[model samples]
Target chain A: MTHSDQISDSDQMPRSAWLCEYLARLEDEQVMAQHGDARILAPAHRLELDPEGWATAAKVAAAMGLRHAGLWADCLDDSALAAEDRAIRMQACLEHAGDYLVLETQVPMLRPVLASQASIYPGVDRLERHAHDLTGLELTSQPDGRRWTRHQAWPEDRFPLRGDFPLAGEPVGRAPADADYPFGRVQGTGVYEIPVGPVHAGIIEPGHFRFHAMGEDVLQLEERLGYVHKGIEKLAVGRDPAGLARLAGRVSGDSTVAHAWAACQAMERATDCIVPARAQALRGLMAERERVANHLGDIGAVCNDVGFAFAHLQCGRLRERWQRRSQALFGHRLMMDAVIPGGVAVDLCDKVVEELREDHAQLKSEIVPIFDVVADHPSLDDRLMTTGVLSEADARQLGCTGYVGKASGLAFDVRRDSPYAPYDGLAMDGAILAEGDVAARVRVRMAEIGNALRWMDRLLKSLPDGPICAQLPEAEAGAMGLGIIEGWRGEILSFIRFGPDGRIARYFPRDPSWFTWPALERLIHGNIVPDFPVCNKSVNGSYSGQDL
Target chain B: MFRILKKSFQTGVVTETPPDVADAEFERIGIELRRRIDVRFSRSLAIRQVDAGSCNACELEIQALNNAYHDVARFGVHFVASPRHADALLVTGPVSRHMEAALRRTWRATPSPKFVIAAGDCACTGGEFGASYASCGAVEKVIPVDAKIPGCPPSPLELLQGLLHVLRG
Candidate 1:
């Protein structure tokens, strides 16, 4: 209880002398030119810190070299929202104690300093070990206090991010099939060890890696994910922003429009709701047709896990003609709840937006000579140029976001770092690369499937018209919103809350496969064990979007 | 020239011998009917599926019987990889005790006349995670199913008409 010796908000002391007296009052208000509204809007002063004031909010975001985005742990409830300053400004600036924790940051002005960006940022060590394995909280010096998102899917003293857990898929029971699964291992001589899965051989989902080789050169790798968790944040606690956009489009069925547009932008920012600039340009043309049909079926399953069967039967016949033109334009072909709460559930019709501009102009004129027959062949560039590499400083010390940290350069892209709505008037383009291998993650997924087929032909030739949906109002109970999106496996944040009569008392989402499943065990070191299925299809990541 | 490729596969113009196994007098009923007609003419299935408390609407109609309109790998059905290279245990959902020991180690690692199917209405009962607590609702309470397929995720032509009713028995 020493972080800022507790005056409880507005000042206090010790999270390193309250981040050196709040960056010396933000460098004396940036030397008398008053640093514009003295910064503070994230997690509203992170509801006056505690839970080791998040290691004094990462030493005031590394004494200001800044650049930190996520650090989570939330359970805000005061009835969860039906409005009254959104349940009195989220139970007066986001409920701190009463259901117990808050800590989350963006840091513009010591934004409620709860800093332990994992001891001044080694990429907040697996986002503070998934907010202390789904919220029991305690992070006091965590460099790996084991249990990263607890797997045998629950019941090791039940935590599923707290607030009276039971969103109801069932099984708050059963444990002990040799119980011990806590994870850590890597010891020596031909390092030996194998494990593989929570069960595998594809039709995906369910995890558990282990590895520790010597013969295959992979000396350390450990992953043991929540085996298909399905309590989807406690059945999205009381539900209803169209049942949490059909449970965030089942969280990761190939990321249904980035989990139903980040659970309908956290139920339209906790019900101030707007949506309709032609349903945000048809939800950015169904999120660039679900990111060019999952980067042309994961660059043809990372070239059919390296045996390149004619670029896996022509990227499975161009992802089955982009899922039969998304079931002839949104009637679900993995489009799922097609973006809901206050906007979009269907409405592309103008002859399905001219058959989605003649099928993305024949998939950008047949993906440039089939990605130049997979970038000039030679056994698919000798098993994808220097195989599973990762680097840009181990993909920014493993926070590894989408297109596997934009092929390792890590530019970050919640539609260009938090823009929201029709990617704030388009132009978007972010396909960086610093050669983090597997052919720069298959040329950053074929340049993000040709920048999502030229931003879905400029969002279907400037789509516009009117109401696809717009009735929202209700959600006000205990408010608290925040969503984020981007998705084809990148940003996808979500948080939500609301309850008391508008329901959903906490929703959560997270999943950029929780920091690219620990950068696929640090990019399968010196790669071999039969090139872990083309390096796990070059970071495919979603085991039901990190087992929900 | 190899008798014009064996007279173009016996005048059928390339390949024609697949239709002779239907019941050729139950293959002369002997030695366990010729080992159940050589294990039903080398059966292929493998499957394992599991979901167990689904609304993945029969896991997208069992992933549209592996696309291309009910292909289910041209009827040999194969989705396998650990139910010990199965022969059939498809399972979808409603048996929740966190998938009852991974559906009883996917039915004691299949390797017999093994077939289970179940497919939908949350694996034949517990449908919407069947009043949750994480379900142990159906798929014949852990293993022996044989065939079920109902909807709410059932139409890849009802998962190729329930994988041809779990291959006719």
Candidate 2:
């Protein structure tokens, strides 16, 4: 522990002896920033460390029951240092309670390898792979070494997210047919494989799923995804705060509001900008509406996959109406780009608020009876029950959240636990189930929809009278900030660093899909092949969200 | 199912009347479409949708085409699973490099006389996710687009209009 920080620490110390005792085990450690109950900033303790200290710190943090939140990388170009010393810096963010403990370390360009966090947090398998894929820096024990974000679009030697690489990659013709990418072999008696798609039949995102099954039961399911890798990470560099917020919104179109808000929050934090109370409430409203719309659509789609056309039609109608309402209020149906760096672009007048309340009331009456019919249907009950069951152990290990984790008894909701603004005062009952089945997931979604509807009502009732936005001060060079939000699917984390003249040096929005997608492989292990679609729908991992 | 049926009976037909002259709010829009449609193809149009790396915002609006209000099915336009049965390809997003080939394979799979509708700002001009190391901007860069629907995600009404324009042409 550092002498300077021990005497000058901001948050005082020793609420828990565990944290203090653990830090005493390490050398050259000190708290970076303390943000207890801050409206915007995470109550994070940042530790600047050498390479060896970082790997050991991660292991210790994991043992202390800290959940691995996210990892992000950017090249650190120091003008004073020799060219060789300028290195790729990677930061690992870990969460315990509402606090985020961040570890930072740099690896020189010559042999850019570091110990992986996969041993501690198995969920970091993809994050390390993503760091490796984009920065060309290798992690010593990354669970998988295969290409991730780059796909085969870029050549072996070229790392697209590196500072030297141009935005336009020099392609030597069409990318070599990706047909030869290796798939896991499940060699046993009568174990065969079915490759689904990078291109699906219906209106859906692209991801290639390889299922190795014995008879009809799936023995192994390995998903090869990156078909939607849009070079968003590479594009994020050099953008202004507003531009970066727009890019974040597209990280996952469905979670547009949440992602944008997270990015904006990160930007606002970096610049020390405090948004108006009204703006925070509006953001909450938008995020909850997004959650409701997606749940409505998904509930219907799950039924549609099972051939319950009536439920499908009813849900579709409801979703459309909901989207229309969003458009009328937020100026975009999906609410894309509604959130900016300082505040929201649109403000709701009294008339709009009144209409929204009436619409909310009307929708409750309209959807409840239809949902009841589907809930009682014998055919649906037979299909969804006990199918693709993800156990509590698997859910916790995979770090799944939102409905997927809630269905399987992982009672972690970022909003309730973290208590960010607009949600700080709202009482959350937590819709959780231990069943770990498809039916349980549907029930969780239904419960969440009701909760979100009420949350909106509460937010509107206590809407503060103030300016919708605050003018943000100009960004300071090399400032860094982290933003985390409870998105519809789960907790989304955004990391932002500013370059010279306030241009973005790096921005990475870590989607909750990274945790949820891997768990799909586990949940679908013994499920039948035909049931994959419904199982996948129940999980509903976003391809774009993860690939980015 | 019986309860659902009873509710359906109580609600009567939730489906809109013939959109032309049915919704007076869009009389001018209906007249605009009625005037511009080329009417070269048959009345019925079968659509095959290919998501070329969209964030799926466009796909949601496209799916809404099947819902009650903007029922494109009532307009003799429905989404078919197979490209062989399709008359037009409704493509979305700036084609990611990984999806570029699969999109071509889909185009090749469709029978002759197929039209491609680049159905978003991304598909039309690479929108925000521009042509880059991992993305090949615009559906037009890889394949020809007959019609372009431009919006971050074109709304269901806008998509319906685009489809009507294609059917009329």
Residue A261 deviation, candidate 1, in Å?
Answer: 1.0
Error of 2 at B27 (Å): 9.3
List the DockQ of the predictions in order.
Answer: 0.06, 0.73
Error of 1 at A252 (Å): 14
lDDT of 1 by residue, B34-124 (tens): 3432466374556777664343334544554453322345445578767777777777756545446756775887778677888767678
* Model 1 CA lDDT for position A99: 13
Q: Which ten residues in a row have the lowest lDDT in candidate 2 chain A?
A: A1-10
The alpha-carbon lDDT assigned to residue B128 of candidate 2 equals 95
Q: Considering every candidate listed, which one attains the maximal lDDT?
A: 2
Instruction: Tell me the TM-score of each prediction against the true structure.
Output: 0.31, 0.93
The deviation in Å at residue A478 for candidate 1 is 6.9
